[model samples]
Target: MVKVATTPLDRTRVARAALKLLNETGLEGLSLRAIAKELDVKAPALYWHFKDKQALLDEMATEMLRRMNEELAADEQPDTEWPDALSAALRGLRRHLLMYRDGAKVYSGTRFTDMSYAAPMEAHLRMLTGGGFTPGAAARAWLTGYSYTIGYVIEEQSMGPDPVKEEGGYDLAARAERLAAYPLAAAAGDEMFRDYDAGFEKGLAAVVAGIGATMRDAPGA
Candidate 1:
C-alpha cells in the first residue's frame, strides 16, 4: 500500500501516524523522530502538535478507547445481565487492543487524555449497580475484569510469534514429572499451557459469577 507522502497533521493524524510507526518499529524503537518522519514532517514540527512522545502515546491510547466506546455504543444490548454485559465489554476491549501492533502495550502504558473517554466505564458502573451490586462492588467488579483482560493481552502480545512457550519457557513435562510426588497438580501439566482462549473465558466467568455472588450475599444485597 502506498502511504500518503504527508498528512494534514492534527492530533488524530499524528496519533494514527504514530501507530503506523509502532507497526514498523515496536515500542522500544518508536520515537517522536520516527513518527515525524512517517508524517513527512520535521521532528520539531511534531512538537507543535504533541508536546512529546508521551503526549502522542496518550492520543494513541485514546484512539483505542475511542474504538472501544464506539463498539459499546453499538451494542444495542447494554442492559443485558451483568455477566453478559461485562463479558461483551471486556471482549470488545480485547478486540480493539489486538487491532494494532503491540496494541495492548500501547493501550496499557498510556492514560486517556480525554474526559469523555470514561463513558463506557460509567455505563458499566451503572449496569452493575442496577444489577444489585453496591456502587463500590460495581466499580470493583468491572475493574477486576478489565484489569485481567488487559494484563492477559499485554503478556500475549509480548510473547511475539510464540505466545505460550519460548525456547526456555515453562517446561510442563519436566515439572509434571518432578511433581509426581503430588499426582493431582502434576496431572495439570499440559493443562497449564493449553489454549489461552479457554482459560481466559473460564477466569472471566469466575470473576463475573463471583460478582453476582458477592452482590447476592451483600448486607442488603
Candidate 2:
C-alpha cells in the first residue's frame, strides 16, 4: 500500500472521505477500512473522529442535509409562497440524495451530529405557522412533507439500479398479466410507477394542501 502523509483528519474530512467511498462502493461496501484507505491513514485513526461506522454515517447524513439546505437557499425567492417553498425544499432534498449510490440509505434513520439544523427547521416552521397552521399542525406538516420525500427516495434508490437510467420505471404491463385476477390491483399497475417525479409532486401538493385546508379554519387562520 502507498503510504501517504496523513493530513490530520477531522469530522468534516472523515465524513467527506466516507461519502467518496459511498459513491464508489455504496453502503454495503462502505467500511472504516475503505474510508481509512481513502484518507491514507490507519483504520484505527478514524476512531478518533467517530466511535464506529454508524457515527461516521450519521455525520455523512448531516453533511448531506446541510448541503441540501444551502443549495435551496441559493435559489430561494423572497416572494415565494410558503407551500411552494416547502415543496421545493423537499424536491431539493431528493435531488441531493440521488447524487450518490445508496445516498438515501445513508440519510434515512441516521442521526445528525448536531442540532444546528435548527435554521432549516425554523424556516419550515415559520412557513407553516405563518400560513395559519397551529404550532402542532405546523410541526406535523413539515415532518410529513420531509418524511414523505425521504421515504420515497429511499425506495427509489433501492431499486435495481440508478433511477437516472432508462431502467428506472416498473413494467406495469408485465405486472398486469401477473395480477390478472385482481382487477384493481391490475388497474393500479400503470399509476403506481409510471412517473415518480410527477407522483412525488402530486403527493407533496396534496400534503401541503391538506395542511393548509385543515389549519385554515382551525385556531390560526
Candidate 3:
C-alpha cells in the first residue's frame, strides 16, 4: 500500500482532528488509528503527543471547554447577577456538548489536559463568592450546576443531536404504552420527551434557585 503523506502533528492538532472525526465516527468508533488516519500519520505518531487514548480524550475535552469559554466570554455582560451568569454558562456548556455526536459522553468524566479550564472556573467561583457564598459553598454551587448541565446534555444526546428536531426518534407513544400500567408515568412521557428546550430551562432554573437558597447563608456569606 502507498503511504499517505504525513502532516506535522501536535496535541492540539490531533485532538481537534479527533473531535472532527468524533462527529463522523462517534466516541465508540474513535481510535488512535482513526485519528492518525484523519491526520495523515501512523497510529504511533500520536503517542509522541498523547500517551494514550485517555490522554487524547483529556485534550479533546479541554478543547471543547476552550471553545465553550470563548462563547461564554463573547456573551458576557457587566454586572450580571450570579444566578443569571451561572445559568448562561450552563446553557452555553449544554450547547457546546450537543455540537458533536456523543459530545457529552466525550466530555463527561475526562480530565483536562491543561490549565485552560482554570481561569473560567476562577471567574465562576468568584461570581458565587461575590453573591455571598463561602468559598466551599461556591465550589459546591459550581459543581452542582456543572453536574446538572453534563447530565442533562448526556440525556439529550442519547435522544439525538437535536432532540426537538428529531422527536420521532424518542417514540413517546411507545414509551407511554410501556408505562400504561402507571397512569401518571404514561401521561408524564409528553412532558419528559416532547420538548427538551423548555425542560432544560425549567430544570436549570430550579438548580440555580436551589443553589442560591442553600448556599447564600453559608458560614462566610
The top-ranked prediction according to TM-score is: 3
Ranked candidates (lDDT, high to low):
3, 2, 1
Question: Which of the numbered candidates is closest to the native, going by highest lDDT?
Answer: 3
Q: Please list the C-alpha lDDT of all candidates, in the order they appear.
A: 0.75, 0.80, 0.86
Candidate 3 pairs with clashing backbones: none
Candidate 2 Cα deviation (angstroms), residue 62: 1.0
Instruction: Report lDDT (Cα) of residue 27, candidate 3.
Output: 87
Clashes of each: 0, 0, 0
How well is each residue in 1-221 modelled by candidate 3, as lDDT tens digits?
Answer: 99887656788899899999988877889999999898878898789888888898999999998898888888886588888989988988888888887889999999998898999899999988988898898999999999999998788778643433443357778888898899998998778766788999999999999998877765336
Residue runs of model 1 more than 4 Å from their true location after superposition: 1-7, 160-189, 215-221
| TM-score of candidate 2 versus the correct structure, residues matched by position | 0.86
**lDDT tens digits, residues 1-221, model 2?**
99977666899898988887787787999999888898889999889888988898899999887777778878876567777878887888889988888888898888899875888888878876776777787888888888888888887677435544435456667889999999999998666566677877887889878767765445445
Error of 2 at 172 (Å): 4.5
List candidate 2 segments past 4 Å from native. 1-6, 163-174, 216-221
